[model samples]
Target: MLKFVKNHMESIEGVATYPMISLLIFFVFFALLFWWVFTASKAYIKEVSELPLENDNNQPKEDLL
Candidate 1:
């Protein structure tokens, strides 16, 4: 099974570049995300962190009839 797949890939031209390009893309994406996380504002972080517990609709709850 492995030999069959390797033989098939060996027939294609420029197949080797595909793995390098994919690795470069993956590395750049994660590097940018890491930079953004580190540079983000503390205040903004705190606000986002509290989103799950925040109640936007302040109206009083109506009693069930």
Candidate 2:
């Protein structure tokens, strides 16, 4: 694997390495962002699901009029 990589690196033309690195960084950022969104959505669902039951007996109703 190292040999193949070394050979390929020697043949690369122009500044392709920077684009590959940038793509890698963007991929990592997107992965982390999606993970955070997934966790936050799960927590929000759990909180919302528990809310009505928790407030059932204590919440007071008010007349809109």
Candidate 3:
């Protein structure tokens, strides 16, 4: 199975560049995400974090009849 797949891939032109392009895309995505995380405001982060708790308290409880 491996040999067959290898032979098929070897026939395709410019297949080697695919891995490099994928690596570049993956690197760029994580780099941007890291930058955003570091640059995000602490106040905004705290507000977003409290959203779940606030909603939980505001929800009405339904007692079974």
Best by TM-score: 3
Over 1-65, each residue of candidate 2 has an lDDT whose tens digit, in order, gives 99999789878785578889999999999999998877777778777776765545645334222
Better of 2 and 3 by TM-score: 3
Among all windows of 10 consecutive residues in model 2, the one with the lowest summed lDDT is: 56-65
TM-score of each: 0.80, 0.41, 0.81
TM-score of candidate 3 on Cα atoms, chains taken together: 0.81
Give each model's whole-structure lDDT.
Answer: 0.85, 0.76, 0.86
Between candidates 1 and 2, the one scoring higher on TM-score is 1
Model 3: colliding residue pairs: none
TM-score of 1: 0.80
What are the per-residue Cα lDDT tens digits for candidate 3 across 1-65?
99999999999999999999999999999999999999999999988876765545554344221
Instruction: State how far residue 34 of model 2 sits from its true place (Å).
Output: 0.2
Give the clash count for each candidate. 0, 0, 0
Model 3, residue 13: distance off in Å is 0.4
Q: Can you write out model 1's per-residue Cα lDDT over 34-61, one digit (the tens) per residue?
A: 9999999999998888676545563323
